[model samples]
Target: MLQSSVTPHPERDRLMTRTRRIASRLRDLRSAAGTLPDAVVLLDHSQHVRWFNHAAEELLGLKRPRDRGRLMSDLLRHTELAPWWIDGAREPLNDVTAPGHPNRHVTATLLPFGSRQRLLLARDTSHLTRLEQIRRDFVANVSHELRTPLTVIHGYLELLDPEDVPELAPVLDEMRAQSKRMGQIVEDLLTLSRLETQDHVADEHVQMVPLLASLRKEAEALSQGRHTVTLDVVAPIDLLGSPKDLHSAFSNLVSNAVRYTPTGGRIAIRWAPSESDGATFSVQDSGFGIPAAHIARLTERFYRVSSSRSRDSGGTGLGLSIVKHVLNLHQARLAIESEPGKGSTFACVFGPDRLLRGTQAAEAAAAGVPY
Candidate 1:
């Protein structure tokens, strides 16, 4: 259709004519990109393909000497690009899968040349598409998990008869506790998801003294009669980051310490700045510590060391997972120290670059990094 009566260019009009010729190469053809020869392909009467690049052969398996003189549709008729060859555009595409390259997606822009010339631009977006799919799937799975417990609680309550089940009080109490645990788990999952997706997080200068005092108070409140915690500040630390985020992070670790420690066991919160050059906060506890075999999976969603024990202790199984995500967001790191019978310590290590001084923090703000 493009190969109509188009006039040939005059010899004196080389620069103007060629630039205009390329500028007019706007055909909405999807069958584009991957120039095997890098030479021009004359699609219609007066318009030629100005150039092609190397990706053509690998992506589409097209070659110049072999494919030249052929109609454009004949060369790309079997591809996802085919629909665009006949029509200028195709309807919005789902993933455009090729036989040899399964689960692949590509994009192209069209250009017009003379009456009917078109240029194809292409890129592989398969990896990005797959990742988005996975994120969606994860979100769905979490939603389903959260809904199950609520459903069970609703069903059980609907069947409850107070007069007939007066002796079932303890069972109902357990049900209520389990429902609360499920709610806690769901909340933690949402929190972890937010932390993972957040574009920016402030890690500000947090002084050690006040943080220790606050943490001690919180630990004492959480420990109650389970264990008495002793506060220990090793290296009087000054950290640069969001104090609130750090507070939550250390709170989670220290709360875990208080919750898991046996009666009369020691729980300690400590801060140290390493010449190895970073800041570290550790919450250590003489609890019924985790076994060597089960440490690595402590951060996985819903993973637990002992299901019954964790349930009895009201563990949501997402505390450490939250810790990991929070630390990673600030470009900080994590370490877990434990012995099966002794105790466990959860520590977060911050790089020296992140531990900026008050002046440096101010300078960074002025310089546009904003800490």
Candidate 2:
């Protein structure tokens, strides 16, 4: 009697088949995730751990059911991680010590997915970090070693009397120029190395009025009546940074303008206010503008748009790299706008935290400063 109505319903059979297929796919996905080298953690909107793979257990020390509702920040308590997490994890946090294994280094990246859910991926970058450190140390040592020899060669070349060697005057001049350029390159490398090694810079009241004026003077001297160099101070605000370091960064921008600009070209240097009470120091030049493709790599060490042109302009190609390091220390950024045959503008954008407007603004307003 019970087997009298053993008929299969087509709709129910189809639904059962679809459900089995979905379950199989989910199991396969879990298997794939468990085998990944990167730690994969699923987080909710509150940044609480919802689920994780086997790699997460090994790398992030996350235990299933035990760390299920625990805060991600609590699991990974890093100073730099807090801000990055709070800021929506827009950028990756690199070379951070792994929470589970202190000796290991990891790069953490968080991406948002369905309905405020986030996927946290932490990859081991310990080897890459060590390689970068080794490269930096090698560069510093080589630059230091080359400095003395370069100085000696430059000194002897300076002492050479062109009048004493009438027949070899041109050769002597060329030798002296080459030596001087080499010395400059060594000095730039040393500066870049030093900047790279430092995590922070001394914060002091940087008088922008005087600093901008001085930079303008340096630019004019470099220009030597060749280019029309001008300084415009639209924002009468000082900065909170190491004066010497700031000067170096700003001077590099200005000098690069003079070097790249053709004779009779216009170069305008401006200190202007930006959004949120921030400031920007920009050097606009009517020179050979950089191509769009080469713009991104401009800050890389020894990166050049035109090697021969850079050499002819007496550039070491490390200037932008140095500027990048300096800006990173100051929590600033460099913005480049260029068009071939039109012009180029290099702007160092500083945040509001680096601006010292309290005293400087009062003084400028009281004195009715006209820049």
Candidate 3:
């Protein structure tokens, strides 16, 4: 060969230095992984274990040589975890307990990286879960204890005669109203507790016409000639759900519309099929609408957009939360649309899976027919 290597490349030294720095950084990262608190695992697109940190070995019970290249499902065998792992869930799984460590609760999250690699992180949530359980228990116990006493007070207040005590008539009337409001709140709390504790609802074909008629009557009574209430039934499809739960959800929305809308305001209740073959029962109102800020927390228990206004309107403030729970049991959702001064529309949109098409009489006789 000819003598062509007389001069070295000018950038050869700089390239070598950069490569050495990169290698050093990678080594440092590997060392840091050994001391992390949360379990960390790296997986390929096929869900095969690429590597795991020291915390993973301790928390997840994953061993280096034995678990490497194995499928993640092969190690964690919880039935509830199978769906999230296989479906490549975008949302993080909360309150998930690994099969081996049933008592140790962990929240698992996945982060995608480097074109086919994924990083799985498991954070211990045992303490937080315990606190949540404590809160629920406290609320349930307090609500149950207050129910009998509240009923007694309400009954006694009802028995109080304004004629017998004419001097304190206005005060007694006010006391009765306040006691009645308290009773309503206590009842709603108990209902909420029962719903949270109960599992799935016993399904049946609920007659829509009768339910709607009942709701209309309630709205009229609540309105007391102050609001113009109208019912528009475009589709006569019965729902496959618990009649009691459905009635509660619908009536809550209707009564809220009646309560909030000003005198002579129009409240339209409509039932129709949605674009997705599902059905929608919506209560549109011309009322003092909700602010954008309050809309997000409208379904939260005891949350009031305007505290004074809600109290004046005799609202228990648990109506939307109850509606939310009922719709959740039926695999449906509430859609609330509003503007500050214009009006509000509360729509309970049921998925196609929950709707039963045909005559109400046929559906009721059939019990529950799939559409």
**Which candidate ranks first by lDDT, i.e. highest?**
2
Residue 153 of model 3 has an lDDT of 87
> Which stretches of model 1 miss by more than 4 angstroms?
1-133, 136-168, 356-371
lDDT by residue (170-287, candidate 3, tens digit) is 9999988998888888888878887877768876778788888889999999888888889989977888888888898899999999889999999999999997999999999999
**Better model by lDDT: candidate 2 vs candidate 3:** 2
Model 1 has a clash total of 17
User: What TM-score, to 2 decimals, does candidate 3 have?
Assistant: 0.87
Per-residue CA lDDT of model 1 for 1-371, tens digit only, reads 57768677677579887777766664312134333322123455432334454565444445656655556666667887777656854443344654246556655445556666665545566777889768956975776677776867757775776568889877876776677667676777677777766756775556657878899999888878668778777655466667777777888898888877888889988777765778788888888888878888888877988888777778888888888878877778788878987999888888887675557655655665521
TM-score for all models, in order of appearance: 0.57, 0.91, 0.87
Query: Which runs of model 2 end up more than 4 angstroms from their true locations?
Result: 1-5, 77-79, 360-371
Best by TM-score: 2
Rank all candidate structures by their lDDT, best first, as comma-separated numbers.
2, 3, 1
Relative to the true structure, how large is the alpha-carbon lDDT of every model? 0.69, 0.88, 0.87
Error of 2 at 169 (Å): 2.0
